[model samples]
Target chain A: MSDRKNLNRAVSVARGYDPYTSEWLEHEFESYALLREHLPVARTEQLAYRRQFNGGWLLTRYDDISACLSDTDVFSSQSSDYPQRPWIPQAIDPPSHTAYRRIMNKWFTPEAMTAMEPHLWDFAGELLDKMLQKDEFDFVADFADPFPTVIFCELFGFPLDDYEQLMDWKNTLMHATDGHSAGRALAVAKAKELGLQTPDEGELPSEVAGQVYGATAAALYEYFGGLLEQRREHARNDMISQLIASEYDGERPLTNEELLDTLFLMFMAGLDTVASAMGLIVKTFAEQPDKRREFIALMDDSQKLTLAVEELVRTHAIVLLPRRVTEEKEFEGASMHAGDQVMCPTMAGNRDPEQFENPDEIIYDRVPNRHMGFGHGPHRCLGIHLARRELRIGLQLLHQRMPDYELHPDKKPELFGGMKGASSLWLRKG
Target chain B: MRVEIIADKCQGHGMCNMVCPSVFKHDEDGFGYVVAELAEVPAELQDEVRLAEVQCPERAIVIED
Candidate 1:
């Protein structure tokens, strides 16, 4: 087949670009390469109908994605109306985004993260002790999922007892389509609240998934709403209470709706991304022993470990940031219309050849590594410092417990897309 | 070289602080700011300061020679 034909085959959105499938995951890098070379801004007929918006342009190069993210006025994060409730700071543009960010930033600073390190280390050790007891286990389910989720709960002041429930709700909201079977039962239960009676037996329709997400989200809002009331009465030294004590633009207290919106955003963002990153990182290590050894070597050295974390995150970049073009204009030979959805998949940008030398390879000490795994610009990940701390502690403890881990020969990692990670990563220690 | 962070442009990615903690420190809100004690980028720390300037995703860091 001609290179162009192969490129077309790889980049065709109509071919059902299901990220859950190994085929799609395998083609992803090749497709990114082809798109960057021949069509940096390629239009898609559909973008996984499961996504909030479909049929838009995909920006596959580093500079273009960076430009799109940096130029927030033109490429707005207020992209979709799907969720209906806007995630504060994430969905809100400028002035408002700034104000919202300010209200929450202090709780996630490097100093706060540093203060939380000993607790994190203890927690990681606790989890690893339990995990290493089993000869073989699903890393995503066993360690990765609970590690970040539990830490986030502790930070947000959610009862540690509710951690399992919180994880189920999150999975229902975010991983329903990714074959997370645990989410299915919870989705059905939540679906009842939405008056949705058993959404068939097999694959949930996109509409049903939307309804389930809404129902799950409402549960979270109510959960946090109650928590907010308690914090209002008597503030605790936790993020929720801190947010309650915060002022918006120094003018007034944040509205209940605003607080809920922000918490909702935090709930989703805090629980999933770090866990997803851990899953991806470990899965990579399981498949590639040499990379694992290199990473293990850096575990004791904080400086080298920091650089290693950046590179692993860069290579396994999961976010596919969507933006709405605010005005019609020509951009890099593509005629973009106002309100058109544009996807800036950070994976493509992180792996763009023009930006990084040997873009696909994970060089633990890649200098000047300005990869946007946590994103860029005003809406960058609020919990970045916490995330870095988590990765460092998580990896350090994991390798210390099981230095010779590998992918289970019988079971394979189920790669998920749309804020990508393995839904299930089976591993065995040698 | 004197270094400063343009507070308006900083969204608190903290790359400046990460790359050069000697010159850059984060506020309680994680926003990067040059250390008040450091009136100038010390000769020893200039290279790290330059890297911080380059690494600031928001381009909020500035150095005047």
Candidate 2:
């Protein structure tokens, strides 16, 4: 592969292998496979490569990706220290990460998430009912986006009315770095259009964009603060109240900053990741009706739900875990510097042929499944249990309620952002 | 038997204290830092300790027999 000097040869081969260039995000899957096939880790001198975005190291091999995640000390989660509102805690490394994570862990446990099953099911059911009422609806807007957003709102004890506004803010925030000037400009415009004003807007004119960008932060902080105050007076039976009442290290109460940051992280991370995954899962099932029927059949058998959920996560890993090298190290013969960023694309890792048989195909009952869909080691997704519970309950309810659903032929599914997942997947219910 | 926890891995999910409250306790960080090591394992609490092992989401605890 190295002897072939023509780079276009590889690109041409990739295009032939995956014909859906128009619809796919970055032709990422094809390129990932090509890179893995050619060299497990290959360097690209592409001008589009930005240092901040994974620092140009894309670990395409499964073992290499897994090794990076496990070695958290050497490979830090502090991918960038740029001053921006931290909407996700997974971006932070240990020590400080420890405290913030503790406050939020209560909300994401299997037990906590299991309790949310009924609510999530109801959310899915209600959304599906609305969709079934219409002849055709945008799957991303009507179902995929709303399902996770509503769940997140409920989890944070926020009003359901704020779902649309929250979704728009999150979308803008995630794609901010792609086109810095344009993205920031769009964010400011959105804030104005939404009639949302930030608290810091009055004090610091220089940081108006920062303030505007962090308006959601202010809103969240105020919301959580009110709940915390209420909980301090008298604890409610909700996750917010539980967090407010939680004692860190033992006797120390969480600071207001810690509480708000943790809540914001959960809200932001939960929205796109789960929604995108759900969209892809539904799209995958729609594309393969046989697999859809098989999944439905498994749903009928109570014992198979866990296996089905595992397979779904494995098959459609949307979020790529990004890590930075905290120490100079040699990994798989590559000399990684202390500041270099490594993007562990879970989708690529999960689909490595060396790890699983027929890596691309969705085997609904593949046992001994150890995919990094929820990630690995300590920094693994805290909300994974909730994500699984939500997915399992949502899918089960969806299959049971609308077993004969099919994708609308007229509408093409939009892949969300640069992430390897669907944004919208329109389906017609029978 | 006593259990030692790597503090860094602990997220203070409270599975340890919830399972074996007599053995494990939360520290200043809201995480379960080791409290005490029991000399003789009470038969009743053995299941509780095992429950802690399974329930700990972080997998930060290791038990010494």
Candidate 3:
């Protein structure tokens, strides 16, 4: 069916593609065709987690998503989190944000990605071998989850033993459904039990949700804040240590809080994104055996393999970033006012027919794939290089070891509300 | 074929490098530039160069024949 029809259906459909709605739960991108056609700048007062104020327009069209992302002045990425606090470069607007990004840019450059490949290849093999040893295992719990987390720990010089704790902290704070963390109480079961509907912008059951988020966030800060101080005294060859010694504004070193904030942003951006991408990649390849074979045939050629990964990234695009309107403005016939949170669905944008020749279908070796999977403009994903590296090597290793892997008989992917990913991907190796 | 990239418009998407490596290369900052000293596309790689021109999100890559 035409996505436009689905989009119109959303109007009468309960939970109409609301991030927390049952309609969205059924499928996130199913209604975007309608959204892009009719509601390029549609406004609503309902949201899943953040209900501070009535919502602004949700930009679903390809051009609109790009316009909002690139227009730094009108659509600012400044801290939209309630009880406003700095979130490093992400929270800061440009000129200043450019400087902070510059400091961290060198850490994730193409050169750095190349340098880390050998290490990543060995590690991916190590993890895949371990998984292959097991006849059947939850791909996520077995490899998809811990693989990136462990790599994250090694990259930042965080204590290796604390990887589990770090994952717990991250999953709890980032992944939530009802009033509890999906990591702890389990989001799917909670969703089923509560059948939670998307609350109006100001109608969120915030008291409990706020406390849960606040408690989790505080614990993460306390843990990482101590690590920053320790790094200051005993610096090492890790990104965390690099951040600690780096200077900004002038010769003044970054404050402990800035360092902590920056690290927090990196944690949220890096680990879950890669892991989620891997789970989907593995799951998709497993289901489409012929497509998997086509991808494997290109595995020996680095250039083609890289292009395949880009196409896969486009097909399974994740992340729904929200930007706040800086002032009253007219954009593509949609009027936006200051302080309105504009939800930009990059995942939907990636599938826009105007951009890709066959946007909905995954085309391996899709040349010139200008996908917004990493987003656009200055605030574009700082970890793009590193993420691409992880996906490339991770998939390469998976196909090499378990060429015939497929999803377990009874299990399907567990997709979250806002972010699209496979939380539970059960696999059986051939 | 001659080529040029509007660096300001280039968000460093890196599609140019993927499409025609011999024609374009991303600098240290991850932005793209014509790799040939003359900023000219070789005839042998002309097809690939056109491919990148289409792929660039910013439409930063331009080709003149």
lDDT of 1 by residue, A262-376 (tens): 8888888888899889999998898899999988987797667777888888998888798988888699888988867888889989998888999999999887788889998
Cα lDDT listed for each candidate? 0.81, 0.66, 0.74
Q: Which is the leading candidate under DockQ?
A: 1
What stretches of model 2 exceed 4 Å from their correct place? A1-26, A44-55, A81-88, A175-188, A191-235, B1-65
DockQ values for all predictions?
0.59, 0.08, 0.45
User: What DockQ class does candidate 2 belong to?
Assistant: incorrect
Off by over 4 Å in 3: A1-15, A20-25, A82-84, A178-205, B19-23, B36-38
Error of 3 at A126 (Å): 0.3
Output the better candidate (2/3) by TM-score.
Answer: 3
| lDDT score, candidate 2, position A265 | 70
The RMSD of every model to the true structure, in order and in angstroms, is 2.6, 7.9, 4.3
State which candidate has the highest TM-score: 1
lDDT of 3 by residue, A1-430 (tens): 5766665665533233467422374656666766666566676655522556445567778888888888889888872663225688777788888779878876776767778889988888888788788988888878888777788788888898887777766766666552222453532333334455434332235454455566667767888888888887999999899998788855789877788788787777777888888888788787888889998899889868777888898888777778878889888876777887888878889988888877888788786687888887778788787788888888888887777877788876666656666778888876
- Tell me what fraction of the real C-alpha contacts between chains A and B each candidate also makes: 0.60, 0.02, 0.33
